[model samples]
Target: MALIGRISLDVVARPQEPTAKKRCLDEPQPDTLKRAKFSDEDYDANKRLRKFQESWKVTYPWVTHEAYDDDQKPGLMFCATCRAYPDLADKSSALYVGCSNMRVDPLKKHEFSSAHIKATNKKTKDTMTMKERSELATNSPIVKATKRCMQITMNILVVMFNTVYSLAKKCKPLSDFETHMELHVKNKKDIGGDYMDIGTNYHNEKRAKEFLMSIGEQLRVTKTRLIEKVRFLTVLADGSTDSSMTEQYTVLVRYVSEGYPVTTLASIEDIENANAFGVKNGIENGLNKIGITDSSKIVSVNFDGAAVMMGCKSGVSALMKEKNPRIVLIHCVAHKLELGVLDAVRSIDYLLKFEDIVKSIYKFYARSTKRRRDLQAFADILESELLHYGDVKTVRWVASKARALRAIQQNLFATLGHLEHAASANKTEESGKAKKLLHEMKSARFVKYLHLMMDYLEIITATSKKFQQNKLLIMEVPDIIKSTTDELTLMIEEPGHQTSTFYDHYDPETGDFTDHGDHVMKLSGQRLTTYEEDNDKTTLLKQTVKYLEVRFMDFNEKPLKCFDAFNLNKWPTNDTELVKHGRDDIKELTQHYIDILTDTEHSSMLREWTIMKNLLRKKKTGINCHDLYCELLQTQPADIQNILTLVNIMVSISPSTAECERQFSAMKLIKSCRR
Candidate 1:
């Protein structure tokens, strides 16, 4: 009974000569069966599965068939390029492997996909050699456009750099960048095309400041690199109060570059303290900023003769020497001369009073425009040009004092005429003051003091100017001091040119004024005895000469005196004298800078020195040390490197801190109250 029931169920499920609708309802269709078979993992050998079509290659060139060993095995479709380089193929795409979905839709979708397009390009690029690819890239329009854009950007940056550098050099405000850019765009259209629009972002003050900072940093880096290459340098520093009432320290470095001494500003920084420690720290910080960490490289330091700067036991100079025992301490020669002259003048009561009167006269005229115009009127009537009255101060420049004295002397008659008119015509307090000044100007004693001071300052002023030279060598300082002292010594017996003119107006024996034709100065005061006048003149001359001798006595001593060996003009004429000349001094110099020279170099220097002297004696050279060094460099010998280095060190020692003073002047101009 069970077999009969099973046979009946099987007969119901089976069908004879199946119709299309019955087959669709009861069994899978041929196409559906083929798709199902293709989806199977082991369907590659199935004949019922869909096969790759050759016609699809016409629609998709990348389409190709996967091969099988058996002819009856089903074929599969894939992207030939993606299959070749599988790394470039999209893993999510059926085309990465072999696709059995034989319809054209999947091939078309992959052909338009980003991955397939990327893969196609990579494959095409790979087929060519490196040189072929390079040529193709070089000729590509896209590459050309990219290069052009980069060039335009660089040109715009160059223009902006130049503009910022110009404005900074002129000390103009950076806010003017936009105005400058506009000017450039209008005048220099060809510099950068369409760069104006791009440069708008950089036209503001913020960007201009950044540009300036970048340029400054680049320049500083270049200067630091140059400083690092030098073996020896001199440090010049000074302290001052700026517009903001901040204690500012200005530092300058002097070194030899290309066989010439160059003095450049290292820094101008605000300091919380101005004592020795503070100043020393500031100098170290400035040197460190320029990459000079080795203090031993410092051959010398120049500063004013302030107690804190020049004190032997504890001062900036002493502190610097603690770091390198060989470092020489230089008291600024200009300041020394100035202090010496002023001290000598102040020692006498009459000259001290004369300075005060000169200052008062300058203030009286300088403060009043009305008085100045009156003075000018008097000057015009006298057929003389009115010179501006300059103030005299203790710490002021000798040149300024000279100018003030010159102005007063040239306009003395005119000033007296104005005062005479103001005192008599006007009845006011100013008139009263004017009368008092008139009385003082008409005194023979005041006139004599004025002429004497003018003569004295003239000699000192010339020496001060010489000391302020940028490349002034230590060897030249002694001669300057001697010449100045000699002139003052001569003035003790004979009066100066200006003073001699005054002597013409007076009787020497009686010390009384003589009436001279057309002389504007009619002296009216208690006449001095010949002994008193002669005593005043002699006292002033003798004191000035003595002060100079005592103050500049260091120039005749050790390390400084050794530099005189380099002064070719001082070399002895005879060979016997020449061979032995400066030998002790040269040894002293090498011993002074012993740390800077190696033992090998120290011994070689003497030999090189002898050779150099002989060579220079044979050659036509300038008498100055710098000129001689230049000649030595031109005919450089194999063993003279040490000698050349010593010469550079000698020349690098500046005679004064004038470079620092000049930098301060520039700083005042650049950072004024209005700025």
Candidate 2:
């Protein structure tokens, strides 16, 4: 709209001046047709100052100075506080203020609406409010009279406008229907509904996000009704990169509990640029929403125990320190347990050996889809009637080596049968390889000792009805140590006790003894009479005594307290295996311990089978307790699963999401739709 002041010049008749000659007006230049350009500093500034002063006079009459020079532009700019050097020559642009939108805090932007009452309470039968006076155009006489009055007023205003500046504004507010129109306009478009046609739609997409945030707030408030409200919560944040994708993570309390399952999630905040102080921003924003923040209420900020997360700069822990150094960074226990188990399982001999065998065996059996199916079928058949998932069926875990040991034993017979069939079908070298595996596998003690390696609970199924049930042993510190020590001494002493008996002489070439070397010989000479006699007696006696005293001690005592019972019952009364012919087979090798577990040790372990049965209480209850142990009554160890089971026992009994899994799940769903 352009403004022009009217100028009137009246002619004073001077001797009846002759009429002026009419000259043709040349057509305007094409360049002159161009609309007015605003390239001048002084003119634009003067106009803006005048307009600003006029607005001030109407809206802020308290200001003293109203007059303004357009060339000087008496405008206080939104960006006048910007850090820049101001120059007088730069009046074409800003001296200090620059082109930028003013900051508007959401709560400060608009006035609330007791001022904007609807004419007829739309949903209720209340009287009309002033703002709604224009909308109450019902068929009732009062409403009709009001509508006619409004129309007459509007017509009177149009006539008045002809006397003033000739209707410079293009847009006009509707005379009636103000309240209903306000509601309709809001329903059709975005927010800021007061000025109907100002087009606030695309400019305020952040409002959509703000609306979603309100929903999240409602969810958190509902979920946290059961928890102790933290006055201020310190957000724990991290950035996770998955397959080169990055997301910002913020953790806040959503659930309420005094002790156990305490919190749930409100939302996931993906970091856009990861502002240098996202942690600070997150903490501040979160605390503000919770509506009770003091710097003191932020007592803790726990983070993943990574170096970066606790480092001195932008770490979640460190960031909180930047604000309040008193905020603590606690370590997550599950992570610590993983580190522990990783350490303990290293350098374990059996596991290393087992891993080697399993990697090979699993690879071979898992070669094709058919073979994998066959394995599952074999596991199922071994499980009879129908397989329950719990039936010692193989599943891979971190210590997969241990499971592999059981696997070799459980399916040995079935494996051998399959290989034999394979040999019959194809007698090639590959088949020969299978035959070799069968042969080598058949030699291992796993098949013979399979029952010993299984969980005691499984053994209860195969147990004889005649035998007594085992008892679980709850071990106290003293008892555990006592059992361990006694078992070791017993194993060590037994061998010597057996060798205490006298044997005379044995033939050199054949083991058969001459009559002089038969049984029941005495300590014939305290001192040897001759060198030959001295040599023989000293050689034999010293060797036998040394073997019992030193070597046996080491072998007997090395196993853990859990295996103590085996040492007690499996000990040797005599170093001999009885043959079918009822003769003793004597061998120097019995003391050599070719098998990792000695026979006497195995026997002793079997004798105290009740103790072995107690070790696996963590897996099943009352299943392995034999009748004898039941008669005796012993407490058993807790059935634990993985290392995390302890953490599960201690911290997770409360049952809230320990992480933002649920909130993240919803957020992920949204992103999936976007893709």
Each prediction's number of clashing residue pairs: 0, 30
Candidate 2 lDDT, 583-662, residue by residue in tens: 11112111122232245543443223333333422323444322222222222223311211111111211111225433
lDDT of each: 0.81, 0.35
Q: For each candidate, what TM-score against the reference?
A: 0.78, 0.32
| Candidate 1: tens digits of C-alpha lDDT, residues 1-675 | 999999999999987876675454766567645643245556644547566777878878888888688875556777887777677678778877678777788988899888888888998898999999999998899999998899889888888888888887887877788898877666546666643544454776777888988987888899999998988899999998888888889988998887778999888877767889988888888888889888888999999999988999999999999888888889999999988887787778887777777887888888788888888888888777778874434224377788888888888888888988888875798888888888887788888877777888898889888899987888989888989999988888777877777777776455554323354445777765542357878887788889888888888888988999887778888999999888898899888888788887788888888887887786535366666675555555676777776887887888899888888887886777865
Q: Which structure among the candidates has the greatest TM-score?
A: 1
Q: Show model 1 residue runs off by greater than 4 Å.
A: 1-84, 87-147, 150-157, 173-201, 204-206, 390-397, 425-427, 505-519, 528-533, 620-623, 631-636
In model 2, what is the error at residue 452, expressed in angstroms? 10
What global local distance difference test value does model 2 have?
0.35
